[model samples]
Target: MRHRHAAAGPRRPRLPLRYLLPSVLLVVVVVMLLLRGYVHSEFLADHRVRPPAPTGTVPEKVLSGGPVLDARGETPVSHRVPDHKIVLTFDDGPDPEWTPKILDKLAQHRAHAVFFVTGTMTARYPELVRRMVEEGHEVGLHTFNHPDLSYQSSARVQRELAQSQLALAGAAGVHTSLFRPPYSSTADALDDRSWPVAREVARRGYITTFIDTDSEDWARPGVDEIVRRAMPERPGQGAVVLMHDSGGDRSQTVAALDRMLPELRAQGYEFPRLTEALGAPGPHSAVHGTDLWKARAFVAAVGVSESAMGVLVVALAVVGVLVVARFALMLLLSAVHARRVRRRRRGRGRDGRRPQVTEPVTVLVPAYNERECITATVRSLAASDHPIEVIVVDDGSTDGTADLVEALGLPGVRVLRQPNAGKAAALNNGLRHASCDLVVMMDGDTVFEPSTVRELVQPFADPDVGAVAGNAKVGNRRRLIGAWQHIEYVMGFNLDRRMYDVLRCMPTIPGAVGAFRREALWRAGGMSDDTLAEDTDVTMALHRHGWRVVYAERARAWTEAPETVKQLWSQRYRWSYGTMQAIWKHRRAVLERGPSGRFGRVGLPLVTLFTVFAPLLAPLIDVFFVYGLVFGPTLRTAAAWCGVLAVQAVCAAYAFRLDRERLTPLLTLPLQQLLYRQLMYVVLMQSWITALTGGRLRWQKLRRTGLLGSAPGALSGSGAEAREPHGLYGPGEAREPRTKSAVG
Candidate 1:
């Protein structure tokens, strides 16, 4: 029965904005992670490069004076720490590992120092920056990203300072006036290249601080050597010492600090913060109001990005393991299944010989608006070598599909007309009218070979066999889009079926070409309209009813594949959603007794993991592939991506060999992975969103070109079976019946 139709209303968009919100959020997270990686890799000074040769650009007094220079006025003035006092300034610091140890040593010796922190490190380890302020240590800006200021524009220099201050305000709620340029040493080392950078710092109201003592602790020198190099040459002569608490192993620096601080204090030397030794006012000013809150938000974003990156790495590892495991299992079990089939064909089964099945079969084709394909479909069934009764169920097609089939007047073919309901309802109607014990179902756009029916029913010779999945090929694979589907069908779908068959937990019998026992269909309540994938739904029902399902590789059918991306997306979105629907509808089978329990435990997990979760996480591989290429080490990144591609190519080649297919189509495998794979990922993700949100999906129909009837050899391995002519009979032409099969 059909439901009453309502008048058409205003058109609604296929995908609502709510359905796309989750994807947009995911993209935001990925972008944040990329930004974090770029900053971490590109910034933060690790080792110093030699400065350029000196030029006449530097002022003579500024170059020959002490380590600290005040250039904010017309004439630059330089100063050193007062006699009997030492100022310890650490660069590239706020390190989570070494900074705490150095601070603890300073506290024990009752000394205070200055930490010149890079903006990147401060943003990452905010607590360390805050502790510096609480412990009475001065914090000075070391610039953000640690770039060579001589090579940067005035605007870039300003941005670097402003960003550093932003991080400081966010972390410690303070702004500082003291600044240190990266890769700087004593004032005497200032060359033509670095002179302008100093002037720019002065224009920005910063007191440029340079170091007089060179510890060289960044090179991991011995602790004793570091302490010796850090000391002033003469007694009562003060100096500003340079050291590091971050970037590589800082154990030597930490150990050197413990020994040097107490010994210097015992010698009547005082270690004071940089400002204290200079007798100047404090450098830091507390932040307030909106500026403080904005800085806090920036810090919070960085923390979230770090946490998201950790989870993405774990997801990447899980996806890698799942992909490798799935490949290994498919290869091993498919070989076993093929070998077993060969042995049975050679009469080597446990019974020594197998029984043959030659009974007539009923083929049901449920079609809606498939007028262009019905003629070829009916003729294909009429040409089968084995006797078969063809029933074309036209489910309220606006086109003249039923009329066209009746006009053909082919022997042993009939047409049934009914109002539009859905595919599952149409299939159930066909099942009610089927006459033979063994029934085969196919789509209106699919064409079968002469031996397809005979080969499909052979598994029924075993009393326990209830359903058989057939090899469905793409018949319009001349285009690149079609070729991609061809590879997927041969490699992904068929190989998986072989593996599942060997495991005795076959999940789905494809609707394009599959045969079923009438008794099994009745036991499973025919087909239900509760899910879009009626075939998968009924197949699970049969498994739960303790019926055996298997695959028949030799039974081949050629079906037209979508040639455009829009059509393909529509088709796949339906499939992905429908599969989820079926999985959810039959989720309880896992805990049942008998065959239901076996399928629930084995088949359900495999389907959920490989079909759902793996694909959801698989996009991370490509995401990181692009990330590595953009960041650095291009050759290594390209090599790693090629390795993953090589694995997939090897598996695809083996699958093609098993299917007796030519390898010409494999030239596009790389492009398929780059482009086609992302489309699938998006489609699967959309399905996940729909399922989680409890959104409803309607049936979508794809337009057919009916190319299989005219060009049967579009794909490889069709053999001699596709040579029959496809011509409609004239109105007066009558074909004699080969078999007098009648419907009960």
Candidate 2:
């Protein structure tokens, strides 16, 4: 539960991940799958290619039936090749290693070859592309970004072709009228579907290219096998041999090139660039400074994207590790707390000293659109055995919340109406008219048990105790969402409260039901509109101002929790974000001495880590699990995921048992993590965003279901026996304190 975007609406938390599910997330997954399929089929699959340096083939009708273009997509303006001549071409590169090495090998063999370049890669390694042009090698276009033109729109195809041309012109100060569609193996391989794209290319005055022979060196097969594959079927055959200078470790290609070029020459074969064999002009486009900078920007953008991806992976791993570590610490600390609580319980018996306080308490009920449950809340408070005064502060609810309270005409209950101020202001208004030194704050949507206030005020018997946090349970927990919330309340909040009790760092006295000494509240500056979680902010202020906060678990109240995911998100976002604000607001307290220093040093970090940072990091576990399912050791990954799940299940089960809740809802914990947990992580992220950006958060109203509806005496009372006959402290016989453990 998180929130604190302090604004008009209860500061709504951006429910980041829940917003992803059932729609936006579906689209993301579909797009990823489509992209993966396209990349795999087009580039990862084995295919034969056309001429290494050829672009689009010339259309016969336009060229008036020029001599047939060869496998390199190069139109032979004149077939001036010798009988023993061979054209060696390398497609898809200007690789730093293999390209230069191939160039060196070619230089050593006194041979030249054409290199078809992908635009992005050419832009990235412009110097290499420049070297190709300067070393008597031809350069051609192989589409920007390397998408298969067969699947691309005409506009996309045009951009791909033109971008490659621009990249070549910028990188090497030259461009060719050559073009090659991605995934091509041979000129003959261009089907009817691709011929139109080829003709479209020809319309732009570019010639297409393909390969007559393939080296298949991208697979890193043995050097000898690559050499064997590159040789033509017959000895001294005149053909275009295709190879790659990039895409993977091309050492075998280099080695094969080292071995084959000499062997081909021994067979009286002459390796020539496609231009030389076809007697075609080697075209080069003029360059400009703007084009060069544009190419530089493209390369820089690619580098940044790669760096960002690496950073994301590292950050996710760090978050996952921290979340795991935090959970382990929670288990450790919770165990220590449980042992201490048990020891204390065993030490205190019926004969132990009993807390007696007969002080008249003032209860504040803050309402907005709570008409449906306001009466029930008043009735429950009216039934408190201890002497009390009830004040209802209505924040101008159009739902007749104030009217219902006044209509009840309940003794000791008064309704005070104010303009539509926020919850914090409403609380402040309640504080203004509260007449008793002891005050209890209750949400209008909550129903307290008869003895809740009596049990709550008992902690004040210790002069040092300034506030008491009551046990808050989910009342509307019938639906799956509500049931999940129920589990969270018992398993997360209450369990943490117990540990916080032992640590004496209880930061929040939940608004649903909390007891505070009037003076303590006043000393803490009462409630402020600065934070949507005024209850939390004020409680932390009390801690820093040297006030002791305790939990009265027996003081149970049923709160009407949000029934739907949307309502839950809004409530929690405010909580998480507001909590962040409060933490930062009181950060300097850590340097102080005494109680404030203790809480600031211990409590603040604990709460921030477990409640805020840990939840934010929790998403990384899911990310890793999903990634592992797709690309890692599946069996080990599943075991590891299940291991974490089992540990959490055990913890939740222990919490539920301690809380005396049924194990039934515990079954939904895993399902809850699938969707509900992500919602929480997103809320925390939104809070951090709010904090970082210093954005205002507004109040978000949730529709009430009046789920905690009950008559004044519907639930059993803890009995008025703990009450004193005369003054609260002048008791004759007082029941000994049962247990200080948080309300389970």
Candidate 3:
């Protein structure tokens, strides 16, 4: 005999570090992406502040001074580029296409220029920044993300400058003290709004640099126009020329640079670096040690995040296609199944008029510690409209469930006691003693309606049908947890069952209520204990044995669902793992010929795709949903999420309509997706971890409240009726029966 102590209940294992590390890395990548603002374009938008109408709050000397300003002392100092020298400074660059051409043209002319790079681009294409430093060009900070710092707070400005420095340090192992605010042009244009920002930049030890001339290259003006505009008006006058090599098509700027560099040199105006033109010390400083490593790590993380985002985008697309395809298949096939059932009811087809099944069936009630529910279960069976001989196999319940059932003394019900063998073994024992050709199996906690047995057996009228799966409804659905499960049953389970039935690949006959032919059971080698989910294992076996299995939607049974999160987790964990085990056990059928091979090709793949693969990847939708909300466009992200939810709601509404259920329960569908669905995903993930590590799972019995038995009318549309107890003995007056046996 199988003892309860032989195997231990499922225990929580310490999460392996391998799994933990990847999760941590993913979180880090997401954070890096958010910090870099690479997923959104708002940071890169060209924002102009219109010079703010010139205010006296700005220092007149600073406003009218040269492009390079330093205000570290009480008296602000400014210096202009030397006469007959031109400082060519490019903004918004490190562009892989245009920056190189501009750099190459300058190199060909032996001319040096300053390229002010944005932190976003610097981090993304570090090689370009490295190349700028290698080619004897000055690299200055233009603020990270190219934000207009005049409108930003001191803290925001500090962060921008610090991040830019970090990017510079990471890319080329050097940082520059020169800074430029995005959207600022010409020192004379600085007003009260921008003058204070320049003072703050000077206070931070940076030489705030502005332009003396605007090339207007960003407008993609003609190359000749750009070159002409970039030149100083006077022959000997010095100028700091502003142009761009990034932020849009810069081919015009590149051509302009190619013509202007040598032409300016030919005009006796030397194109020198900004610091050289200003006659100041070099601003670039080499980074070392921990700071260098940290900067490099930051850049490495940004690169990884970009790559990971690409992969996630592809995964999201794949999930999108899978979800839409599954929904389409379910909606179409479920309608076909419903229509066929309607036609059968109307007697409109060749095989529509099936004879009513009236033969007595032996119902097996497998009980383990089910004293609270045994009485109502036996009474409900005795009240069945269709004749049934119920064998209540009490599998070593410590609560005296066998004595309680025997005491009830229902006329057609017999109590058989045995040692604490597992549920599958108890089922097999019950099957051995059944005298009826048709057998119905149900859990001890399930309460069937008066007509359930009749409707369940009606499918047997077709000789090829070997088994029928019944509709299992949640009885305690007034609670939130139960309501979520009710929605899942209606949408995820029942609707999928309809589709699977249409495809002739129904994977599971739920243990709550199902019926099978004795010949089919015998041919399939009875219920085996190899898998925790005996019902599913046996169902797959019958398919391989060449017997047809189908769904009986009219045969509805009310069973209590798990009430708490902990209970739900344990129950689903077992179900997930057990289903995987059963699928793995029947894997060989896929390679075989005949009915087994047919089931293997059609049923196995569908089951794997819908049940295993789809759900495993489904979490990516929510993952990216959160990612988009944080780092991407909020309106689009929310709209996409609602679109997916709306599709789910449609499918759920149709499922409820088909099952003749009320739609009020669907109000919690969004919450179910937000919270309840995540728990199920975690359960499935843990199951995968357990399976991959070759961990064993034992049977877990949920704590029942006997709610289904106590209140049969609580479940709507279950067709349940409350019946008074009728038996040979009163509730507590009978002795134990003699039909007990031990199994070895």
Please tell me which predicted candidate would have the highest lDDT against the true structure.
Answer: 1
lDDT for model 2 comes to: 0.72
Ranking by TM-score: 1, 3, 2
TM-score of the candidate numbered 1? 0.93
Clashes of each: 0, 49, 0
Superior candidate under TM-score, 1 versus 3: 1
Once fitted onto the true fold, the runs of candidate 1 whose alpha carbons sit more than 4 angstroms away are: 1-15, 43-50, 710-744
Clashing pairs in 1: none
Between 2 and 3, whose TM-score is larger?
3
Top TM-score hit: 1
Query: Estimated TM-score per prediction?
Result: 0.93, 0.69, 0.90
Stretches of candidate 3 off by over 4 Å are 1-57, 104-110, 629-632, 710-744
Q: For candidate 3, write residues 173-275 as lDDT tens digits.
A: 9999888888888888887788788889888889888888899999988998998899887787899999998989998887887788777778788888888
> Alpha carbon lDDT of residue 133, candidate 3?
86
Q: Candidate 1: how large is its RMSD?
A: 5.1
Cα-based lDDT for every prediction: 0.83, 0.72, 0.82
Clashing pairs in 3: none
Prediction 3 global C-alpha lDDT: 0.82
